[model samples]
Target: MTNELIQAQFGPRAMDYVRSSVYARGESLGALLARLQRDPIRLALDIATGGGHTALVLSPLAKRVVASDITGPMLRVARDWLAENGAENGLFCQHDAGLMPFPEGTFDVVTCRLAPHHFADVGAFLHSCVRVVRRGGCVAVIDNVTPPEPLAVRFINAFERLRDRSHNFEHSLPDWEAFFSTAGLRIEHRQQFRTPIDFGAYCDRMSVPERTRTRLRVMLLQAPAAARAALNPREVDGRMTFDLGELLIVGRRAAR
Candidate 1:
């Protein structure tokens, strides 16, 4: 049921994600690229490759990249986008992140960017990533994160769910650390950054109706002082904008 809902929500907006400035360019992407460049990657697996942006970025760094997504429509869009961009080393596959259809230790590097908050089972997904990545290889994750404060976490997650039904919940930094440990991956590097979201574009990308958008706007505006302060909503030239906290975590699979 969750997978069906996610596919339905994202299938039509595949191109929007491909062209989205937030996904196409970001410090997190740059950081991931730099980290990958430090070592040569024989083959990389990009799970939940929404628009093939991360695979495109990894194409030059890795000899081969498998861009996998669960949704057929999304995978098709990614394939088309990758072909159009001349990213020849990328291969598209329809696969679930939590249950990848690849042999263990098949990839030298694994990545999932800007997509895990929607994952139904992030721990299982990480375990699959660990299973597929060779020992001493890298697993990079870039996703929006919630604050440690219980109220702040609740508010941000509520806001996300209200805006997009596909959203699960944003995990905190500590949660990610624990997940990596449980997956037998050692966290080598971590960084936190903010991504500015244009409120209008955010709504339009999801094709949110005007009534729901209005309600969301009111909710944001009426949020408690603590929540509002954590969100840091701002209006510039009559356009609403806010920052979403994001995290980049690079871990290494431990050798036997």
Candidate 2:
């Protein structure tokens, strides 16, 4: 049921992600590229490669890149987009993030960007990443994160689910660090950035129902002071805008 909801929500909107300015252009991408330039990447795996944006970015840096997604339609759209962009080193695979089909030590680098919130078991996903990457290989993750406050976390996740049922939960920075430690990956780099989201475009991306959209707006407007302060919702030129907290973390698999 969870997989079905994810596919249903993302299949038709694959192109939107392919063209999304926020996803395609970000300081996180620049930072990832800088790191890649410093180290050599022979083979890479991109988990849940929506629209293949990350794969496209990695194609030139790595000898080969496998863009894996659980949704067939999403993978198809991503493959087409990659081909259209003349990216020859990218291969699309249909597989779940929690349970990848690749053998152990199959990749030099593994990346999941802007998609971990949809994962049902982020711990399992991290484990899979550690298992597939060779010793001392890198795993880069970028996703939206929640504040540590319980009220803020609850309100933000609730609002997100209202907009997109596929959303699971956004993990906090501490949660990510703990997961990495448990998975036996050493944290090499970490950074946070504010990503501005246009509320109208956000709702439209998921094809949210009008009633739900109305409710979301009301929730944002009537949220408690803490929630409002955490989210910082506001109106800009007749459109609602808000900033989402995003984290970029790079961890390396243990050598021993």
The runs of at least 3 residues in candidate 1 whose Cα sits more than 4 Å from the true structure, single-residue gaps closed, are none
TM-score for each prediction? 0.97, 0.96
Q: lDDT scores for all predictions?
A: 0.90, 0.89
The superposed Cα distance between candidate 1 and the true structure at residue 52, in angstroms, equals: 0.6
Worst 10 residues of 1 by lDDT: 223-232
Instruction: Report the lDDT tens digits of candidate 1 across residue range 1-256.
Output: 2888889999988889989999989989999998999988999999999988899999989889999998888888888888998888888889778989999999999999988999988999999999999988999999998778788888888888988999998988999999999988999999999888899999999998999999888877887776676667889789998888889999999877
